[model samples]
Target: MSCCGPTRRTLLGAMAVATLSSALGAGASRAQRNSLIATDLELVTVTDRSVIMTWTTVAPDASGQPVPVASSGAVRVAPVGSAPVTMYESAEPTPFHYAEITGLEPGRRYIFEAESEGVRAVSALNPVTLAPDAPEVCGEFTTLVPPPGRLLRTFALGNDVHYGETVSGLIVGDFPPGFRSLPDLPPYPEVMLAALLDDLRAPDRGAQRLILAGDLTAEATPSQSRSVRAQLDSWGALGRDYLVARGNHDRPHTGADYASCAPATADHRDCFTEFFVPREELVQHEIGGLRLLGLDTSELDGTGGRIDRPQFDHLTGILTADPDRPTLIFGHHPVTRTSGATALAGPGFILNASDSTELQTLYTRAPGVFLHHAGHTHRNLRTRPDTPCDVEFLEVASVKEYPGGYTLLRIHEGGYMVSFYKTRTPAARQWSALTRNEYFGLIPAYTLGHLTDRNHVVHRDFSGLT
Candidate 1:
C-alpha cells in the first residue's frame, strides 16, 4: 500500500475541510456525532528497521455513506517494554493516513496504536468496545532479519498495467458497477504507469532493470500497445533495459480496432506481437550471469493459459542446456494450483491445472531456476508449490489500482530479497487511495498481503553472478 506524499496529504486535507464543513452544516438538522472515527487500519509493510501503517478517518453522514474527515493522524509505536515514539503526518489534516515508523530493531516485536483527532482506530483484529481504559493495541509485528550478503543489483518487477481500460474489478459475466477514475482526474492507468516509472527512476530505488510480467494493455488494440510502448520507451531501451511478457488481455482479437495490426500466429490480429515480439517467439536474456526467461502464457480468446508444445520444448532445451545458470522465469498467468483460494478470477485465472503440473515437474529438473514472477491476480502473494523444486511463485499486485506499485528484487552475493514499493508520486498515491474502495471495499483484504509476503529474503549462493 502507498504512503501519501506531502502534496497528496495537502490535497486530501483541503478536500476533508470542504467535506467536514458541509457535513456540519447539514448535521444541525440531523442527529450525528461530531467526533472522528478511524477505521480500516492496516499494517501495510514491516522490514528490519521500519514499519508502515495506513487507515482512514470518516464523519458520519445522514446518507449513510461516511464523509472523509480531515484530522491529524498519528501512530504510537514501541517495543514490548520500551517508551513509545509518536510519528505524525504533516500538519495538514487528511482523511487518509500513512505513517512510517523507522529506526526499529530487527527481530524484535513491536506494538502500535493509530489515532486521529484523539479517536482511536479500529482494525480487523480490534473491535469497538466501550471501555475507556483499553490497552491501545491496534496491532503488533516482529521485524525480520536483514537479508545476508552484499546487495548486487536491484530490478523492478511489475505487471497488470491495463492501459486503455477505464474501469476496474469488472469480472466477465459479473457486470456490476466497477471502480472508475475520478471524473475530474486523468485516466488512472496513465497516472499510475507514469508514477511507477518515476519511482523507479529515483536513485534511491536502485532499479537497474525493469520487467513487466503481463497485461500491458486492456484489449491489445494497436493504439493501446503503441501507447504503452511509448511510455516504456521514455524510461529505458527495450530488450536491453526492460522486457515484457504477453498477458491474456494482450491476446489476439478479431475486430476492426485491430484490423490494421500484423497477422498473429493465431487467426486474429495481435498488436502485442506486432510490436514486442514480431517473431512471436519465447524470450531469453543473459544478464551478468543471470538468465531471464519470458514465457507467452496467453491463450487465444481465453483467459486461461497452456504452454504450447513448441514453447514448452524451447524452455526445456534452454534449461537443459544450462541447468545451473541461476534463472528466473516470468509470465502473465501463475501456476493455478499454487495460487491458492484468493484468486479472484476463479479457477481459470491462471495456467490450466495440467500445464501447472507439467511446469512444476520441469522446475524440478532445473535446479538453477529460483523464481517465477506472474501478475494476473492483481494481489501480492508468495507461494511455493508442493513439489520438491526449490522455487518461489511470486505474484505481484497491479500497477493501475489499489496498492499501486511494483516489487523490487534485490540480488546479493549470498542471497536475494524481494520487497514491494508503492509508487510515491502525489498523483499516483491519490489514485491509489481512491481505488482502495474497489471490490465492494474488500480490495485491501485481498491485495495488501502480510508483511512477510510483501518483504522477505531468501538464502542462496548468488556469489556466482557479477
Candidate 2:
C-alpha cells in the first residue's frame, strides 16, 4: 500500500527471485536490502557569500563507500518571502561530506534540506540570515565604527579559547603547576562562538569585529585544531570575519613532544593560519572611519608572550605609513603589563610592566593610536596613559572564567559607550559566586575591608584621548 512498494507484477517477480535465491541458499541478495544510517549532520557558513554543508555516514558494509548514484539529494535555499527557491544537487562520497554553496546576498534569511535512498530526513529549517555590514551582536557588545570627528568606540578584547581543561587536569595534556581553577564551561568554543554569531546577527548593534586578538585552541592538535577551524567557519557562515591574531597556544611549543607532533612549522601553523588569518603580515578593516589593526604578537619561544623584531617593525611601519588614520591595536597580550606586578600583592598576573611601558612608548608616539585592546589577564580592567592621550589600555574578561563575559563598545559622533556583560550561563553564575567566596576567605583581615575598594578602582576612562 506504500507509495514506494512494488506493484503486483514486480512483487511476483521479486517473489520468484527470492524463492530461487532461497532454494540456492544465497546470502548476498538478502543483505543488499538493508537500510543505511546517517549521523553527525553539520551545517556551516563558510563566508557571507557561501555556506559549507557537511555530515558523516555509517554504511552497512565497511568495504564500500556511500556514493550518490544520481542527482537525488537536493539542497534548497530561499528568501523570507514566497520567492522562488534555488536548488542544488549534492555531490558525494558524503561519508564525511563538505559542500560550498555560493551566490548568497548579504543580510538575507535562508533555509535548506536533504534526502537519500527513498528515505526523507528534514532538518530544523532554522532561519539563517547573511552577516550584517557591522559586527553583529555577540556577548555584551555591539560593534561600532568611529566616524570623522566622532567619539571612538573602544573594545574589551581577548582570545586563545583553550577550553575543556579542568582545575584538576587538562583533557589533553599535563596541567601547569600554577593553574588555579578550571570549571566546565558551556559550548566550549564552538557553541560559544555560535552564540556570539547569533548575537551579531540579532537586529541590535554589532561589533566592528570581535578582534579575536589570537590562539583559539590549546594546541594545534588534529582534533583541537579542527574544532577551532569549525568555529571560524561557523563565524564566516554567519557573515562575520574575525580579526584573528596569533597566540602561543595556537602554535606548537618548543619541546620534544611539539617537534614529534608537528613535523613542519608551515604545516602546523598553516592548519590555523589558513582559516583564521586574512593575510600574512597584517589584517586591517575600517570601522566608521577608524582603522583596526590586528597584530600577531605570538613568538616562536615557548615562554610568556612577545612581539618579534620583525612584527614590531612591521607595526611601526604600518602606523607610520598611515599617519592620518586613527588606529586601534589588538593583540593577545598587553604590551605594558605582562603580569600585574606592583599592586598590594606586588605583582598581579598581566603583561610585564617593562614590556608594557615599551609598547606604550611606541603607541604614544603615534597620535592616531586611540586604544590598545588585549586579553591575557582574564579580568576586566582598563588603564589609560599616565601622561595623557586619546589612548586606552583595555583588558577583556575571559569567556571561560569568573567574570566569564565580554565588553561592548558603542562609538558615536561625540564619544563611545562601554559596558561589560557576563556570560549568562547557569554554571558560570554558580562559579562566579564561588570565586567571590574564595576571594573573601583567602584574603587577610586587613585586606578584606579594602577588597571592594580595590575592585572598584580598577576600571579606567579614555574619552579624553578621543
The sequence of per-residue lDDT tens digits that candidate 2 reaches over residues 244-351 is 676656655444434445343543323445445532356667755677887665655452566556666777787778765667778776554323442222233344
Question: Which candidate number would show the highest lDDT if scored against the true structure?
Answer: 1
Off by over 4 Å in 2: 1-160, 164-195, 237-240, 254-271, 278-280, 337-339, 342-355, 386-389, 425-466
Instruction: Give the least accurate 10-residue stretch of model 2, judged by summed lDDT.
Output: 133-142
Q: Give the alpha carbon lDDT tens digit for every residue of 1-466 in model 1.
A: 1122223332333334323323422333232347455655556666667776676676655654346666788888788777666855546777667776778898887777788877766543222111122122325567767667777788899999999998877865456446667556678899899999998878767798899888999998988999989999998988988998889889889977888887774568878876686433688887889999999999887888778888999999999888988998999998846584558777787888888888889899999999999998898899978588999899999999888989989888877777787786656755666666565546766786656678887888888898
Task: Give the backbone clash total of model 1.
Answer: 0
TM-score of each: 0.86, 0.52
Alpha carbon lDDT at 249, candidate 1: 89
Q: How accurate is candidate 1 locally (lDDT)?
A: 0.75
- Report, for every candidate in turn, its global Cα lDDT versus the true structure: 0.75, 0.44
